[model samples]
Target: MIENRNEFLSKIAKQLGRPQPTSRPERNFSFSPQHQVLANATQEELVDALVEQCKNIHTKAITTTTADLVATLKQVVTDYKATSVITSTDQRFADFGVLPLITEHWPQQEVATHQWQERCGQDNITFAERADVGIMVSEMTLAESGTAVLFSDKDKGRSISFLPQNSIILIPKSTIVPRMTQAATTISAMIERGEQVASCVNFITGPSNSADIEMILVVGVHGPIKMAYIIIEDQ
Candidate 1:
Protein backbone atom coordinates (compact mmCIF):
# COMPACT_ATOMS: atom_id res chain seq x y z
CA MET A 1 0.00 0.00 0.00
CA ILE A 2 2.78 2.42 0.86
CA GLU A 3 4.60 1.77 -2.42
CA ASN A 4 1.51 2.33 -4.59
CA ARG A 5 -0.06 5.22 -2.66
CA ASN A 6 1.13 7.88 -5.13
CA GLU A 7 -0.01 5.84 -8.11
CA PHE A 8 -3.47 5.40 -6.59
CA LEU A 9 -3.83 9.14 -6.05
CA SER A 10 -2.58 9.90 -9.57
CA LYS A 11 -5.44 7.90 -11.09
CA ILE A 12 -7.99 9.79 -9.00
CA ALA A 13 -6.43 13.14 -9.99
CA LYS A 14 -6.59 12.19 -13.64
CA GLN A 15 -10.31 11.40 -13.37
CA LEU A 16 -10.85 14.80 -11.73
CA GLY A 17 -8.94 16.51 -14.62
CA ARG A 18 -6.24 17.86 -12.34
CA PRO A 19 -2.61 17.07 -11.68
CA GLN A 20 -1.71 15.36 -8.46
CA PRO A 21 -0.91 17.91 -5.80
CA THR A 22 2.67 18.11 -4.56
CA SER A 23 1.40 18.27 -1.00
CA ARG A 24 -1.87 18.54 0.90
CA PRO A 25 -3.65 21.85 0.44
CA GLU A 26 -3.78 24.33 3.28
CA ARG A 27 -6.95 24.58 5.31
CA ASN A 28 -9.06 27.65 4.50
CA PHE A 29 -10.79 27.82 7.83
CA SER A 30 -9.10 29.02 10.99
CA PHE A 31 -11.42 27.18 13.33
CA SER A 32 -13.17 23.81 13.31
CA PRO A 33 -16.43 23.16 15.19
CA GLN A 34 -15.40 19.61 15.93
CA HIS A 35 -12.21 20.84 17.54
CA GLN A 36 -14.24 23.23 19.68
CA VAL A 37 -16.66 20.76 21.26
CA LEU A 38 -15.59 20.11 24.85
CA ALA A 39 -12.28 21.72 23.92
CA ASN A 40 -11.91 23.24 27.38
CA ALA A 41 -13.68 20.58 29.37
CA THR A 42 -12.21 19.79 32.75
CA GLN A 43 -11.32 16.21 33.54
CA GLU A 44 -14.46 15.91 35.66
CA GLU A 45 -16.61 17.30 32.83
CA LEU A 46 -15.08 14.87 30.40
CA VAL A 47 -15.93 12.01 32.72
CA ASP A 48 -19.48 13.27 32.95
CA ALA A 49 -19.78 13.34 29.18
CA LEU A 50 -18.46 9.81 28.97
CA VAL A 51 -20.96 8.54 31.51
CA GLU A 52 -23.85 10.24 29.74
CA GLN A 53 -22.79 8.92 26.39
CA CYS A 54 -22.38 5.44 27.78
CA LYS A 55 -26.02 5.43 28.77
CA ASN A 56 -27.06 6.00 25.18
CA ILE A 57 -24.90 3.11 23.99
CA HIS A 58 -26.38 0.72 26.56
CA THR A 59 -23.23 0.65 28.63
CA LYS A 60 -22.82 1.17 32.34
CA ALA A 61 -20.03 3.54 33.38
CA ILE A 62 -18.92 4.58 36.83
CA THR A 63 -16.16 6.76 38.20
CA THR A 64 -13.96 5.78 41.12
CA THR A 65 -10.85 6.93 42.85
CA THR A 66 -7.63 5.01 42.41
CA ALA A 67 -7.88 3.85 46.00
CA ASP A 68 -11.25 2.23 45.27
CA LEU A 69 -10.42 0.86 41.83
CA VAL A 70 -9.98 -2.76 42.86
CA ALA A 71 -13.14 -2.82 44.91
CA THR A 72 -15.09 -1.11 42.17
CA LEU A 73 -13.82 -3.59 39.60
CA LYS A 74 -14.71 -6.45 41.89
CA GLN A 75 -18.24 -5.11 42.20
CA VAL A 76 -18.52 -4.98 38.41
CA VAL A 77 -17.27 -8.54 38.20
CA THR A 78 -19.98 -9.62 40.58
CA ASP A 79 -22.56 -7.58 38.74
CA TYR A 80 -21.77 -9.51 35.60
CA LYS A 81 -21.78 -12.77 37.56
CA ALA A 82 -18.64 -13.80 35.78
CA THR A 83 -17.51 -17.40 36.21
CA SER A 84 -14.51 -17.75 33.90
CA VAL A 85 -12.53 -14.64 33.02
CA ILE A 86 -9.84 -13.56 30.59
CA THR A 87 -7.73 -10.43 30.81
CA SER A 88 -5.11 -8.72 28.71
CA THR A 89 -1.58 -8.55 30.11
CA ASP A 90 -1.78 -4.83 30.66
CA GLN A 91 0.72 -3.22 33.02
CA ARG A 92 -2.10 -1.06 34.35
CA PHE A 93 -3.51 -4.12 36.08
CA ALA A 94 -0.41 -4.10 38.28
CA ASP A 95 0.00 -0.34 38.46
CA PHE A 96 -3.60 0.19 39.53
CA GLY A 97 -3.53 -2.62 42.11
CA VAL A 98 -6.14 -4.67 40.25
CA LEU A 99 -3.91 -7.56 39.26
CA PRO A 100 -5.06 -9.47 42.32
CA LEU A 101 -8.47 -9.91 40.71
CA ILE A 102 -6.78 -12.05 38.06
CA THR A 103 -4.14 -13.57 40.32
CA GLU A 104 -5.91 -14.22 43.63
CA HIS A 105 -9.39 -12.76 44.14
CA TRP A 106 -11.05 -14.74 41.36
CA PRO A 107 -9.10 -17.82 42.26
CA GLN A 108 -10.29 -17.61 45.85
CA GLN A 109 -13.83 -17.44 44.53
CA GLU A 110 -13.16 -20.67 42.57
CA VAL A 111 -13.31 -18.81 39.27
CA ALA A 112 -10.94 -19.64 36.44
CA THR A 113 -8.80 -16.77 35.19
CA HIS A 114 -6.98 -16.81 31.91
CA GLN A 115 -4.48 -14.21 30.79
CA TRP A 116 -3.72 -13.76 27.10
CA GLN A 117 -0.71 -15.86 26.14
CA GLU A 118 1.02 -14.79 22.93
CA ARG A 119 3.13 -17.95 22.64
CA CYS A 120 0.24 -20.25 23.47
CA GLY A 121 -1.30 -19.45 20.05
CA GLN A 122 -4.93 -20.64 19.64
CA ASP A 123 -5.19 -21.14 23.37
CA ASN A 124 -5.90 -17.42 23.69
CA ILE A 125 -8.83 -17.57 21.26
CA THR A 126 -10.22 -20.75 22.81
CA PHE A 127 -10.10 -19.25 26.29
CA ALA A 128 -11.51 -15.91 25.17
CA GLU A 129 -14.37 -17.66 23.40
CA ARG A 130 -15.35 -19.56 26.51
CA ALA A 131 -14.63 -16.85 29.06
CA ASP A 132 -17.64 -15.24 30.71
CA VAL A 133 -15.98 -11.87 30.81
CA GLY A 134 -13.06 -10.17 29.11
CA ILE A 135 -11.11 -7.47 30.95
CA MET A 136 -8.64 -5.02 29.48
CA VAL A 137 -7.37 -1.46 29.75
CA SER A 138 -8.58 1.28 27.43
CA GLU A 139 -5.60 3.21 26.09
CA MET A 140 -7.78 6.21 25.27
CA THR A 141 -11.38 6.98 26.15
CA LEU A 142 -13.52 9.23 23.95
CA ALA A 143 -16.04 11.18 25.99
CA GLU A 144 -18.28 12.20 23.11
CA SER A 145 -19.05 8.60 22.18
CA GLY A 146 -18.18 6.74 25.36
CA THR A 147 -15.72 4.75 23.27
CA ALA A 148 -12.76 2.72 24.41
CA VAL A 149 -9.72 2.87 22.17
CA LEU A 150 -7.76 -0.34 22.37
CA PHE A 151 -4.46 -1.09 20.69
CA SER A 152 -3.77 -4.78 20.22
CA ASP A 153 -0.27 -6.19 20.57
CA LYS A 154 1.42 -9.50 21.25
CA ASP A 155 0.36 -9.50 24.90
CA LYS A 156 -3.12 -8.22 24.09
CA GLY A 157 -5.28 -10.26 21.77
CA ARG A 158 -8.20 -8.60 19.96
CA SER A 159 -10.39 -11.61 20.63
CA ILE A 160 -10.60 -10.74 24.31
CA SER A 161 -12.78 -7.78 23.34
CA PHE A 162 -14.93 -9.54 20.76
CA LEU A 163 -15.27 -13.23 21.53
CA PRO A 164 -16.45 -12.89 25.11
CA GLN A 165 -19.98 -12.61 26.44
CA ASN A 166 -19.14 -9.54 28.45
CA SER A 167 -16.45 -6.85 28.28
CA ILE A 168 -15.22 -4.92 31.29
CA ILE A 169 -12.78 -2.19 30.31
CA LEU A 170 -10.65 -0.28 32.79
CA ILE A 171 -10.24 3.36 31.86
CA PRO A 172 -7.92 5.94 33.38
CA LYS A 173 -9.50 9.32 33.99
CA SER A 174 -6.59 11.19 32.45
CA THR A 175 -6.91 9.30 29.21
CA ILE A 176 -10.36 10.71 28.55
CA VAL A 177 -10.45 13.03 25.56
CA PRO A 178 -13.28 15.19 24.25
CA ARG A 179 -13.82 13.02 21.19
CA MET A 180 -12.21 11.14 18.32
CA THR A 181 -10.71 14.34 16.94
CA GLN A 182 -8.27 14.44 19.83
CA ALA A 183 -7.67 10.71 19.62
CA ALA A 184 -6.81 10.99 15.92
CA THR A 185 -4.49 13.92 16.59
CA THR A 186 -2.63 11.97 19.25
CA ILE A 187 -2.18 9.03 16.87
CA SER A 188 -1.02 11.36 14.08
CA ALA A 189 1.57 12.82 16.43
CA MET A 190 2.83 9.32 17.14
CA ILE A 191 3.18 8.70 13.43
CA GLU A 192 5.07 11.97 13.08
CA ARG A 193 7.46 10.76 15.77
CA GLY A 194 8.03 7.54 13.81
CA GLU A 195 6.50 5.51 16.63
CA GLN A 196 4.91 2.23 15.64
CA VAL A 197 1.19 2.30 16.32
CA ALA A 198 -0.63 -0.97 16.68
CA SER A 199 -1.96 -2.21 13.36
CA CYS A 200 -5.32 -3.13 14.86
CA VAL A 201 -6.70 -0.17 16.76
CA ASN A 202 -10.24 -0.78 17.93
CA PHE A 203 -12.65 2.05 18.66
CA ILE A 204 -15.26 0.09 20.50
CA THR A 205 -18.43 1.91 21.49
CA GLY A 206 -19.99 -0.01 24.32
CA PRO A 207 -21.37 -3.47 23.52
CA SER A 208 -22.10 -4.63 20.03
CA ASN A 209 -25.46 -3.34 18.86
CA SER A 210 -26.61 -3.79 15.28
CA ALA A 211 -29.71 -2.41 13.57
CA ASP A 212 -29.26 -4.10 10.23
CA ILE A 213 -32.22 -6.48 10.26
CA GLU A 214 -35.26 -4.34 9.41
CA MET A 215 -33.66 -1.65 11.60
CA ILE A 216 -34.24 -3.68 14.71
CA LEU A 217 -31.66 -3.19 17.41
CA VAL A 218 -29.92 -6.45 18.24
CA VAL A 219 -27.24 -6.60 20.87
CA GLY A 220 -24.20 -8.90 20.91
CA VAL A 221 -24.46 -9.85 17.30
CA HIS A 222 -20.95 -8.64 16.48
CA GLY A 223 -19.22 -8.46 19.85
CA PRO A 224 -19.79 -8.79 23.59
CA ILE A 225 -23.39 -8.81 24.74
CA LYS A 226 -22.64 -6.46 27.60
CA MET A 227 -20.00 -3.78 28.04
CA ALA A 228 -19.10 -1.72 31.09
CA TYR A 229 -16.48 0.85 31.88
CA ILE A 230 -14.89 1.49 35.25
CA ILE A 231 -13.08 4.79 35.07
CA ILE A 232 -10.22 5.06 37.53
CA GLU A 233 -9.11 8.42 38.85
CA ASP A 234 -5.41 7.95 38.23
CA GLN A 235 -4.86 11.57 37.31
Candidate 2:
Protein backbone atom coordinates (compact mmCIF):
# COMPACT_ATOMS: atom_id res chain seq x y z
CA MET A 1 0.00 0.00 0.00
CA ILE A 2 2.83 2.40 0.86
CA GLU A 3 4.66 1.68 -2.44
CA ASN A 4 1.44 2.13 -4.45
CA ARG A 5 0.73 5.45 -2.72
CA ASN A 6 4.27 6.67 -3.45
CA GLU A 7 3.95 5.64 -7.12
CA PHE A 8 0.64 7.47 -7.44
CA LEU A 9 2.17 10.63 -5.91
CA SER A 10 5.17 10.39 -8.28
CA LYS A 11 2.87 10.02 -11.27
CA ILE A 12 0.95 13.11 -10.25
CA ALA A 13 4.21 15.06 -9.84
CA LYS A 14 5.37 13.90 -13.28
CA GLN A 15 2.06 14.99 -14.82
CA LEU A 16 2.61 18.43 -13.25
CA GLY A 17 6.02 18.53 -14.99
CA ARG A 18 7.97 19.03 -11.80
CA PRO A 19 10.09 16.76 -9.56
CA GLN A 20 8.81 16.19 -6.04
CA PRO A 21 10.73 18.55 -3.77
CA THR A 22 13.01 16.65 -1.39
CA SER A 23 13.74 19.64 0.86
CA ARG A 24 11.75 22.48 2.40
CA PRO A 25 11.49 25.42 0.06
CA GLU A 26 13.27 28.66 0.99
CA ARG A 27 11.01 31.69 1.01
CA ASN A 28 10.54 35.02 2.77
CA PHE A 29 8.26 34.31 5.71
CA SER A 30 8.34 37.72 7.28
CA PHE A 31 5.22 39.45 8.48
CA SER A 32 3.55 42.10 6.34
CA PRO A 33 3.85 45.80 7.22
CA GLN A 34 0.50 45.91 9.01
CA HIS A 35 1.39 42.84 11.02
CA GLN A 36 4.85 44.21 11.70
CA VAL A 37 3.31 47.40 13.04
CA LEU A 38 1.25 45.40 15.48
CA ALA A 39 4.24 43.24 16.38
CA ASN A 40 6.18 46.40 17.24
CA ALA A 41 3.46 47.79 19.49
CA THR A 42 4.38 48.71 23.05
CA GLN A 43 3.44 46.53 25.98
CA GLU A 44 0.76 48.97 27.08
CA GLU A 45 -0.69 49.05 23.56
CA LEU A 46 -0.77 45.29 23.33
CA VAL A 47 -2.52 44.96 26.68
CA ASP A 48 -5.05 47.59 25.75
CA ALA A 49 -5.75 45.92 22.44
CA LEU A 50 -6.11 42.54 24.07
CA VAL A 51 -8.57 43.85 26.60
CA GLU A 52 -10.55 45.69 23.97
CA GLN A 53 -10.82 42.65 21.74
CA CYS A 54 -11.78 40.42 24.62
CA LYS A 55 -14.56 42.75 25.71
CA ASN A 56 -15.83 42.99 22.16
CA ILE A 57 -16.31 39.24 22.19
CA HIS A 58 -18.13 39.33 25.56
CA THR A 59 -15.12 38.07 27.46
CA LYS A 60 -14.22 39.92 30.66
CA ALA A 61 -10.71 41.30 30.68
CA ILE A 62 -9.34 42.80 33.86
CA THR A 63 -5.94 44.30 34.43
CA THR A 64 -4.19 44.55 37.78
CA THR A 65 -0.76 45.20 39.20
CA THR A 66 1.21 42.30 40.63
CA ALA A 67 0.81 43.75 44.11
CA ASP A 68 -2.99 43.90 43.74
CA LEU A 69 -3.49 40.53 42.03
CA VAL A 70 -4.65 38.73 45.14
CA ALA A 71 -7.12 41.47 45.95
CA THR A 72 -8.34 41.52 42.38
CA LEU A 73 -8.82 37.75 42.41
CA LYS A 74 -10.85 37.99 45.57
CA GLN A 75 -13.02 40.59 43.95
CA VAL A 76 -13.58 38.37 40.91
CA VAL A 77 -14.50 35.38 43.02
CA THR A 78 -16.92 37.45 45.04
CA ASP A 79 -18.39 38.99 41.92
CA TYR A 80 -18.99 35.62 40.34
CA LYS A 81 -20.07 34.10 43.63
CA ALA A 82 -18.01 31.08 42.74
CA THR A 83 -18.30 28.40 45.39
CA SER A 84 -16.29 25.52 44.00
CA VAL A 85 -13.13 26.16 42.01
CA ILE A 86 -10.75 23.94 40.03
CA THR A 87 -7.32 24.95 38.86
CA SER A 88 -4.04 23.77 37.43
CA THR A 89 -1.23 22.92 39.84
CA ASP A 90 1.15 25.30 38.15
CA GLN A 91 3.76 26.63 40.59
CA ARG A 92 3.28 30.17 39.33
CA PHE A 93 0.00 30.35 41.20
CA ALA A 94 1.88 29.65 44.40
CA ASP A 95 4.73 31.96 43.44
CA PHE A 96 2.24 34.75 42.82
CA GLY A 97 0.68 34.12 46.25
CA VAL A 98 -2.78 33.64 44.74
CA LEU A 99 -3.29 30.00 45.75
CA PRO A 100 -3.04 30.71 49.47
CA LEU A 101 -5.42 33.61 49.16
CA ILE A 102 -7.94 31.39 47.33
CA THR A 103 -7.73 28.75 50.04
CA GLU A 104 -8.11 31.33 52.77
CA HIS A 105 -10.98 33.19 51.16
CA TRP A 106 -12.95 30.11 50.18
CA PRO A 107 -12.00 27.76 52.93
CA GLN A 108 -15.21 25.75 52.76
CA GLN A 109 -15.47 25.81 48.99
CA GLU A 110 -14.12 22.73 47.23
CA VAL A 111 -10.89 23.60 45.46
CA ALA A 112 -9.49 20.91 43.22
CA THR A 113 -6.01 21.10 41.75
CA HIS A 114 -4.87 18.77 39.00
CA GLN A 115 -2.94 15.97 40.64
CA TRP A 116 -2.39 12.89 38.48
CA GLN A 117 -3.10 10.08 40.94
CA GLU A 118 -5.28 12.05 43.33
CA ARG A 119 -7.33 13.51 40.49
CA CYS A 120 -8.06 10.08 39.10
CA GLY A 121 -8.84 8.72 42.56
CA GLN A 122 -11.32 11.52 43.28
CA ASP A 123 -12.76 11.53 39.73
CA ASN A 124 -11.48 14.98 38.82
CA ILE A 125 -13.77 15.14 35.77
CA THR A 126 -16.83 15.01 37.98
CA PHE A 127 -15.39 17.71 40.21
CA ALA A 128 -14.51 19.91 37.26
CA GLU A 129 -17.94 19.48 35.71
CA ARG A 130 -19.54 20.72 38.91
CA ALA A 131 -17.06 23.52 39.54
CA ASP A 132 -18.27 27.10 39.52
CA VAL A 133 -15.00 28.30 38.14
CA GLY A 134 -11.84 26.93 36.57
CA ILE A 135 -8.62 28.91 36.87
CA MET A 136 -5.44 28.59 34.84
CA VAL A 137 -2.28 30.49 34.01
CA SER A 138 -2.09 31.10 30.27
CA GLU A 139 1.17 30.19 28.55
CA MET A 140 0.68 33.05 26.10
CA THR A 141 -1.97 35.55 24.97
CA LEU A 142 -2.44 37.09 21.54
CA ALA A 143 -3.57 40.69 21.37
CA GLU A 144 -4.91 40.65 17.83
CA SER A 145 -7.62 38.06 18.49
CA GLY A 146 -7.77 38.12 22.29
CA THR A 147 -6.80 34.45 22.46
CA ALA A 148 -5.28 32.65 25.44
CA VAL A 149 -2.96 29.72 24.72
CA LEU A 150 -2.92 26.82 27.18
CA PHE A 151 -1.03 23.56 26.87
CA SER A 152 -2.45 20.53 28.67
CA ASP A 153 -0.13 18.45 30.84
CA LYS A 154 -0.21 16.47 34.07
CA ASP A 155 -0.32 19.64 36.14
CA LYS A 156 -2.43 21.57 33.64
CA GLY A 157 -5.15 19.18 32.64
CA ARG A 158 -7.53 19.96 29.75
CA SER A 159 -10.70 19.42 31.76
CA ILE A 160 -9.80 22.10 34.29
CA SER A 161 -10.04 24.73 31.56
CA PHE A 162 -13.08 23.44 29.67
CA LEU A 163 -15.49 21.71 32.06
CA PRO A 164 -16.41 24.48 34.50
CA GLN A 165 -19.21 26.99 34.19
CA ASN A 166 -16.74 29.84 34.11
CA SER A 167 -13.04 30.15 33.32
CA ILE A 168 -10.54 32.58 34.83
CA ILE A 169 -7.21 32.80 33.08
CA LEU A 170 -4.23 34.52 34.65
CA ILE A 171 -2.01 35.99 31.96
CA PRO A 172 1.21 37.79 32.73
CA LYS A 173 1.52 40.99 30.74
CA SER A 174 5.01 40.00 29.61
CA THR A 175 3.60 36.96 27.81
CA ILE A 176 1.17 38.98 25.73
CA VAL A 177 2.16 39.08 22.07
CA PRO A 178 0.81 41.00 19.07
CA ARG A 179 -0.67 38.11 17.12
CA MET A 180 -1.12 34.35 16.80
CA THR A 181 2.03 34.08 14.71
CA GLN A 182 4.10 35.34 17.61
CA ALA A 183 2.48 32.88 19.97
CA ALA A 184 3.06 30.02 17.49
CA THR A 185 6.71 31.05 17.13
CA THR A 186 7.20 30.84 20.88
CA ILE A 187 5.61 27.38 21.01
CA SER A 188 7.78 26.26 18.09
CA ALA A 189 10.85 27.45 19.94
CA MET A 190 9.86 25.47 23.00
CA ILE A 191 9.49 22.33 20.87
CA GLU A 192 12.88 23.00 19.23
CA ARG A 193 14.47 23.23 22.67
CA GLY A 194 13.28 19.68 23.42
CA GLU A 195 10.51 20.81 25.76
CA GLN A 196 7.78 18.29 26.47
CA VAL A 197 4.91 19.86 24.56
CA ALA A 198 1.53 18.71 25.67
CA SER A 199 -0.88 16.78 23.50
CA CYS A 200 -3.35 19.64 23.39
CA VAL A 201 -2.49 23.30 22.88
CA ASN A 202 -5.79 25.11 23.22
CA PHE A 203 -6.13 28.60 21.78
CA ILE A 204 -9.26 29.88 23.42
CA THR A 205 -10.76 33.07 22.04
CA GLY A 206 -13.85 33.55 24.15
CA PRO A 207 -16.78 31.74 25.72
CA SER A 208 -18.19 28.87 23.72
CA ASN A 209 -21.09 30.03 21.58
CA SER A 210 -23.29 28.63 18.84
CA ALA A 211 -25.86 30.34 16.66
CA ASP A 212 -26.86 27.37 14.62
CA ILE A 213 -30.48 27.20 15.65
CA GLU A 214 -33.03 29.93 14.84
CA MET A 215 -30.17 32.43 14.55
CA ILE A 216 -30.19 32.82 18.30
CA LEU A 217 -26.86 32.85 20.05
CA VAL A 218 -26.21 30.30 22.74
CA VAL A 219 -23.20 30.60 25.01
CA GLY A 220 -21.33 27.88 26.88
CA VAL A 221 -23.21 25.08 25.21
CA HIS A 222 -19.99 23.23 24.56
CA GLY A 223 -17.60 24.74 27.08
CA PRO A 224 -17.43 27.44 29.76
CA ILE A 225 -20.25 29.96 29.54
CA LYS A 226 -18.17 32.82 30.80
CA MET A 227 -14.49 33.57 30.22
CA ALA A 228 -12.46 36.07 32.22
CA TYR A 229 -8.89 37.18 31.84
CA ILE A 230 -6.80 38.64 34.63
CA ILE A 231 -3.77 40.37 33.22
CA ILE A 232 -0.93 40.86 35.67
CA GLU A 233 1.09 43.91 34.76
CA ASP A 234 4.22 43.41 36.81
CA GLN A 235 4.72 39.68 36.36
Q: Which numbered prediction scores highest in TM-score against the true structure?
A: 1
How much is 60 displaced in model 1, in angstroms?
0.3
Model 2, span 189-217: residue lDDT tens: 98999988888999998888988999998
The reply for model 2, stretches above 4 Å from the true place, is 1-37, 108-122
Clashes of 1: 0
How far residue 139's Cα lies from its native spot in candidate 2, in Å, is: 0.5
At residue 13, give the lDDT of candidate 1. Answer: 95
Worst 10 residues of 2 by lDDT: 110-119
- In order of listing, the candidates' clash counts read 0, 0
Candidate 1, clashing residue pairs? none
**True-vs-predicted CA distance for residue 8, candidate 1, Å:** 26
lDDT tens per residue, model 1, 188-210:
99999999999999999989988
